[model samples]
Target: MPDTPHLAAQPALSIFYQLLQFRDQRRKGGGMEAIATTLTEQDMRDIAAHYATLPAPAPQTGGDAQKIARGQQIAQQQYCSSCHGAQLQGQKHVPRLSGQSHAYFVTQLRNLRSGARADMDGTMASAARSLTDEEIEAMAAYARSLP
Candidate 1:
């Protein structure tokens, strides 16, 4: 059972609970580190199914072209379009960034840059780590302006 009821609404929190359970078990004589090293096929399947149920985000639009163009240059140089989509519609597994709240985007980017958030591909973390504070601000601003 979760320590807090609010966590019940978050599947990721449940996953983290399971991970903690595995870690605790490993500390004992359970010795299942190898098995706990990665997610099982069932775990992956369940997560994918849950992820598919997420509602599609609403579109957002409008921003200065010059600012967006500068952001686009940074994005292109970073090859962000390869995963985020040329139009910022987002691709498989990559979360929709366009239309996301600027503050949220900036926070997540900072998390990735600071190693506070574990990016699946390591590419994002590396890319974020290379970005200056100004670049992150610009990217977040541009992403928030996309439709």
Candidate 2:
């Protein structure tokens, strides 16, 4: 099974937006739809706030150096930080990428690329459109290696 995302330290607005998407069936849920449906708007807001107050997850260790380097290069080339924040810590409705689970990140990227996932804006889809599978893997490795 894929690793679940560590919601701690994520932007509250981002979490709330995702919850709304899941609730509205605008995004692919993978079981989140039912849970989201049970939440009132206030419940979603409270959940987002609670998670945002928690400490961020620690970075994964022992990643391949080459992959990390390539991922960093790709991220810079793609200007990922322009929206995700300088250290990928995220802001407002944008999600934090630092320390995200590799499997989940990879899956999301692929889904974005293929239009299998719904993005609030087309930016993520556009950004992901040209990525090769290798680049996706490298990006995931880089994100996981962050502190």
Candidate 3:
């Protein structure tokens, strides 16, 4: 199984929306549905707020240089920063991509590409559509290397 996402320092709005999706059965996996189903709106909000106040996850190291570079190139070409922020730290409703676990990132990307994941506005699905398996791996490598 892929690792759970590191939610610390993620935007509260993003977390809140994701929780709503899980609670409503829009986004599935990681047993979040079961957990979210028990949360009231206020409970979700408080959870989001709490996670947002925590520090970001530490940067991962030892990624392949070439793969990271290719991923950076792909990210730029994809205009990821337009919604994700300059450093991929995420915007109001965009989850932070930096410092994500490689396995988790790749799985989510694959899920988005396969239409198995729920994209809030279809943007993530659109963005992920053209990515090849190699590209996804490289992108995950890049994301894991960020601080």
lDDT of each: 0.61, 0.91, 0.90
The whole-model C-alpha lDDT of candidate 2 against the native structure comes to 0.91
After superposition, candidate 2 runs with Cα above 4 Å error: none
Native-referenced Cα lDDT, model 3 = 0.90
Better of 1 and 3 by lDDT: 3
Model 2, range 15-35, lDDT digits (tens) per residue?
999999999998864799889
Which residue runs of candidate 1 sit more than 4 Å off their true CA positions? 1-65
Model 3, runs deviating above 4 Å? none
Ten-residue segment with the worst summed lDDT in candidate 2?
Answer: 1-10
Compared with the true structure, what per-residue lDDT tens digits does model 3 show for residues 1-147? 357999998999999999999999999998999999999999999999999999998887878999999989988999886888777889899999998878899999999999999698898999999999999999888887887
RMSD of 3: 1.1
TM-scores of all models? 0.60, 0.96, 0.96
